[model samples]
Target chain A: MKLLKLIFKNSLRHKLRSSLTIIGIAIAIIAFGLLRTVVTVWNSGVDAASANRLITRQAVSFIFPLPASYRAKIASVPGVKEIGAANWFGGVYKDKSNFFAHMAVDDNYFVVYPEFIVPKDEMEEYKKNRNACIIGSQTAKQYNIKLGDQVVLEGDIYPGRWEFNVKGIYTPRDQNTDATQMLFHYEYLNETMLQQSPGRANSVGWYIVQIEDPNNSASVSKQIDALFMNSTAETKTETEKAFTQGFISASGAIITSMNFMSFAIIGIIMLVLANTMIMAARERTREYAVFKTLGFSAKHLTGLILGESLLISFLGGGVGLFLLYPLIEGFERAMPKGFFPYFYVEPITIILAVTATLLVGVLSSVFPIHRALNTKIVDGFRHVG
Target chain B: MADIIQVNNLSKSYWRNSLEIPVLSELSLNVNEGEFLALMGPSGSGKTTLLNIIAGIDRPTNGSVSVSGTDISKLNESALAKWRSSNVGFVFQFYNLIPVLTAFENVELPLLLTKLNKSERKKHVETALNIVGLGDRIYHYPKQLSGGQEQRVAIARAIVTDPLLLVADEPTGDLDKNSADEILTLMERLNKEFNKTIVMVTHDPHAASRASSLLHLDKGVLSTNGQSH
Candidate 1:
């Protein structure tokens, strides 16, 4: 215990160097945490997908639409329990400065995905009113829109201002729900489209089909795709998770690059920590010799040095985690809903970071501590500093 | 008095690349129990090397170093270290008190090797500090103390563990006359009162005069320099 106290005091001999090393470690930990969170955020969409549901969209791209008449044909499939259609409304709130996802979805969407918890009475109101809309929890908070309030959105793709009455606020059951989306009656959008361009209103963007047996999702997906293989809008049907995973795969290079950058940060941390430990060891050569002369064994001296290194890593990681916690919370609040439904530091990331920091501490100290232990007591005594 | 330290034809050589330089050649000496012995030699006469070997801080190139009847030369480096901790107290020229520790803590260092609890260690440290006349300055760090005070604290640390031998190399080499006198007086008092066996290496005649016996080293040969005073 006395030796431990001495080791601790010795570490403070060079305050500036110790503090700078700790700060360097903290920066690396924070950067690594942020990168891991970004990767997790990208995968969050797939995690939110429902196992029992499948989505059918244009085979080559999601930009193309299929004939609305295809919905009846898909509903008739044996494994499919229900079907609902939703289209990207491509609208913004007020002006271009305000940005949020606006989707035109049918009343059956609320039933097709029951994971979205909606107030029972509000569901009936949404189905009855043609101009009513359902907003995600975050979107409602952002616009301060209540159930009875009215909101107006400007359309870029369809043109002109669109008005709707807020009918309900939907909360996500888990990480998969998009909280930044604004879902309104598709009939309202189709009626306007029919008045302007009758041909466009006759088509739908995508179909969401829930299955009776979750295990048959893949077979049903194949059946749905075969049904439209010869049609004008060739379809691709897959489980909801596979569709979301496909979207995430589009940014494959970006994720790979971020992972490589994290490794680079770890390397930098090791170099910086090793350098700091070297300087510390150099400064204490004579003191170590004194300890040696006073009866401190080589292992005792090494423990003193390694103890300092471990303390530095433990402290830096703690402070970095403290800073990261609030930043992740604030980010979850500020980011558009549904985008990063769960932007958080998972237990695995925390555990890995802590383990990595400890490894860094041990690795950084090994060279210096070995050199110190190998130094002859006489030579150490002769050292001026 | 019986011999406490025996050096048998000890030799030490330093290596510089392919060259070998002899520092001490076939040196032999003996120190008795409860003796105050001073070692004197010219600048390159290997007085420090001889002291280091006797303290088991360094090994001889040839021959054996028997301290308190144990062959320290035959012990492994780690075993020698443990033996040195229990058997030797080292006082360096510049009063090498750990700069960051307080005077009391410096004295407490050797006691860390002992099986004593904290209270017992503290008691031993306080007693050691009191013996050196620095009981009031126990909490002061090396930088806060004067040259004489620092040496006194070093003396306290050296005697804290009550080792079999106390080896001081130029204990007053860096101090002025008054401080050096105070240091010498403290060493003399420790020798006389505590019955400690002290071997001090010094070039200072005034410092050497305080010892009960003196050995002068010239070109690695030892001869007795009588203590008349």
Candidate 2:
């Protein structure tokens, strides 16, 4: 313990150098943590997907819609318990920059997703009104929306101005669930399309099937896909998790690059720490000689060097993590509501950061410790520094 | 008087580009217990090398150095270090104190190698510092102390472990004339009062005059006849 105290004092001998090195290490760790969090947030959708739910979309592309009649056939599948349908309603709220996810979902959409919590009275009002819409709590708070307000959506795909009455505000029960989506009655859109453009009616972007047992989701998905084989709009059915993962895989290279960047940051930290420790050891050549002359063993001197390195790295990592929490909270507050709703550093991420710092500490000191111990006592005494 | 240090034909050399450069060659010496012996030599006379070998900080290339009856030249590096911790104390010309440590901590350094607990180590460090008349300056760092005070702290550090022999290399070479005389007086007291066997290497005639006996080395050879001044 006294040796550790001496090591600590020696590390602080050059106060500015040690402080700058520690700050550099802390910055690297923060960068690493941010990169990992980006990857985690990107995959959060897939992580939150319900295991018992399956999504059936057009086999060719999600942009292509399937016939709405597939919902009834999908509901007849043996293990399927409930079914819901939704169409991609590409709309602009007030300006192009004010973007939020707006989907046309069937009345049973809320039934299939019980994780979206809504007040009983508001849900009843939504069921009674054909033009009623339900907005997520986060979106509602952003636009300062309330019940009975008219929300006008300028359609981009259907090429018309659609208006609806806001009837409910829903909050997600799960942390990973996106809480910035707006869902409305699909019948309203279908009926309007039937009156204005008959060819676009009776089409849905996807069908959500809730299964009786989560374990049978894979077989049920296969059965549903087989039923739609060779149809006008062939359906591809998969677990919701797989469906979400497919969306994320569209940017697989970006995710891979992010993972690489995280590791690269740690490597950079190791080099910086190694350089600092080497410089310190070199400067203390004479001091090490003094210790040797005072009867300190080579093992004791090596331990002192390694202990100093480890202490610096651990302190830097701790400071980095301490600074990261508030930075992440600020980032969460600054980002668009739905863009990264779950931007949080997980406990596992903290563990990884600490482990990486410790490894960097140990590995960085190895060469310096060897150099210190290999110094001959006679030569050390002659060293001016 | 029983000899505390016995050197038999000790040799030390360095290898530079496959050529052996002899620093100390076939040197023999002995010092009685409680005696203050000074080694005076010109540059390249191997005075420091002989001191290092005698203190167990360096190994002899060919012969043996027995201090307090242990053949230190035959001991391995690790064993030599352990033996030195309990048996030898070293003082250097520039004080060689760790700049970051206070005087008390510096003196406490050698005691850390022993089985002494914290309080025991503190007690020994205080006693050594008080003996050197730097008890009030125990909390001062090396930079905060003057040359004489730093050297006194170094001396306190040397004796804190209560080693059998004290080896000094040019102990007053960097001090002013008055500080050098003060350090010499302190060394004289440590020898006469505490019965420490002193082997000091120096080029200063005044420093050599303070020793009970003096020997001179030239061209890696020690003169047989020593003189007392």
**Who wins the TM-score comparison?**
2
Indicate the residue-level lDDT of A334 in model 1. Answer: 77
Per-prediction DockQ: 0.72, 0.77
Off by over 4 Å in 1: A50-52, A75-82, A210-220, A327-349, B225-229
Model 2: per-residue Cα lDDT at residue B193: 97
My TM-score estimates for the predictions, one after another, are: 0.91, 0.92
For residues A1-385, could you state the per-residue lDDT of candidate 2 as single tens digits?
A: 7698798897788889889888988998898888888898898888889999999999999999999888888889899999999888989999876767899999889999998999999999999999999998888887899999999999989889999999999999987777878899999999999999999999999999999999998899899999989878888998999999998897999999999999999998899999999998988888898888777887798789989999899889989999998888787777765567557897778889999999999999998888889989888877765
Residue by residue across B130-220, what tens digits does model 2's lDDT show?
9999989989999999999999999998998888999999999999999999999999999999999999999999999999988988778
TM-score of candidate 2's chain B against its reference? 0.96
List, residue by residue over A281-369, the lDDT tens digit for candidate 1.
Answer: 88788888888998899888888889988888778878777788887778766765445544578777788778878988899999889
Scoring only the A-chain of each prediction against the true A-chain gives TM-scores of 0.90, 0.92
TM-score of 1: 0.91
Candidate 1 DockQ, CA atoms: 0.72
Q: In candidate 1, residue A347 scores what lDDT?
A: 75
